[model samples]
Target: MQRRDIAEMLLLAALWGASFLFMRVGATDFGPAALVFLRVAGASLLLLPLLAWRGEVGALRAQWRPIALVGVVNTALPFALYMVALLVLSAGLASIFNATAPLWGALIAWAWLGDRPTPLRGLGLALGFAGVLWLGIDNASLRAGSAGVSPALGIAACIAATACYGWTANYTKQRLTGVPPMAVAAGSQAFAALATLPAALWWWPATLPGPTAWAGAAALALACTGLAYLLYFRLIARVGPAKTIAVTFLIPAFAVLWGAMFLGERLTPTMLGGCAVILLGTALATGLLRTRRSRPAGSPAP
Candidate 1:
């Protein structure tokens, strides 16, 4: 990759990593549904203009059904789940769990799409789940977060969210094949915004959020969701998905850094160990590492 490509990838990772921070800051005031609604709605506003400018709005209209499905599964549900998880879990830990999406995606594709894993990838799946189990066990305290939600519930929410992401990967490949990337991004966000609107209204916070919370919401929408997607697609177009997917591995590190810096979140030894194991497993499961010098069944691009 060129220096520009590398720099863009890093920026993408940073933006996504900071999403957890933004969620933590905003979720307290806006609540999960409202915060996620803001995110998708704002992202839709940003990307729709670009789609119109590129003359791909027709593609979105033509493929509205599948794109809307992707919006609900990929954007709305997962975003709300993460917002809920972030309420109780530390950003660093939640970010590590987020890294397990590929593992789940591999498992789902194996079952649903017949893209079975090689023996090495089977091992990767084992290792990844073991890491998740380790982290979950370690953090399974019944104590509630500031919002009075249990860490266990938070863990469950993260797993559910990642599973939704995993399922969407195969769904997109099968249902939305050949759609323009920008159209999918913009259209999905638009549909997600619409789907989440009622809940956002119903659960909107009684007390108005402060400026910091509002700023967090705006940044989450404009920077993390909108701009980050643009950077992600650019990298994929320039460097290809294999290299662009490296951003996934880089995100947890940045999340940990940002959490520590801004939220004063500290990591435990167990957390660090679990993160290493999960990333290692993800690398193997995604075919980033070769075990027998032969390609495994392809995992879909992130």
Candidate 2:
């Protein structure tokens, strides 16, 4: 990969990693459903003009079923799950757990697409689970004894959210391959906003949040959702889905840094070690560490 592409991937990772921090901040004032609604609503408004400019509005209108399904699974449901997990889990831990999306993607691909899992990939999956287990076992703050929910439950929620993300990743690749990324992003956000509107209304706060909370929500929508999706689509176009999806590996690092900077959270050795293992597993699942075949001894090996 070129240096420029690598830089873009890193930037993408940073933006996504920052999302955990944003969600943690915003969740203090908004319920999970309300936060997700505002996020999708804000992103939809920001991207609507772009969709109209590209004359892709009709495509969304025509493909409402799959578009809405993708929106619900990819944006609404997983975002809400992450927000709920953030309510109990540290930003760094949540991001690290979410990084398991690629592992689940590999499993989903094997089951749904009939893609055989290599031995290395299987070992990578086991190592990834071990990393998650280590995080759960070592993180006292995630336990009920530490004034939080059970550590196991928090970990489960994070893994479930990532599994949803994994499913949607392959789903989009197979079903929505030819569609414009902007359209997919915009339409999905719009649909998610619509789906979450009633829940947001039902759980609406008694009073409005201060400007800080409102601004954070807006930034989550605009920067994290709208702009992030644009960058993600660009990366997907430049490098195929597997390579673009590797950004999950960097999210934990960025998440930990952002939490330390903004939330005054402490970084621990366990967190660092877990993040490393998760990234290594992601590399294996994405085939980043796999060696390409070459002719051996002047004869074809295959």
- Against the reference, the lDDT scores of all candidates come to 0.92, 0.83
For candidate 1, write residues 1-302 as lDDT tens digits. 89999999999999999999999878888999999999999999999999999999999999999999999999999999999989999999999999999999999999999998989999999999999999999998888877988999999999999999999988998988788899999999999999999999999898989888888899999999999999998898899877787888999999999999999999899999999999999998987876544644674433
In TM-score terms, candidate 1 sits at: 0.96
User: Per-residue error at 70 for model 2, in Å?
Assistant: 0.9
| RMSD of candidates 1 onward, in order | 2.8, 3.2
The number of the candidate with the highest lDDT is 1
> Where does candidate 1 stray beyond 4 Å?
295-302
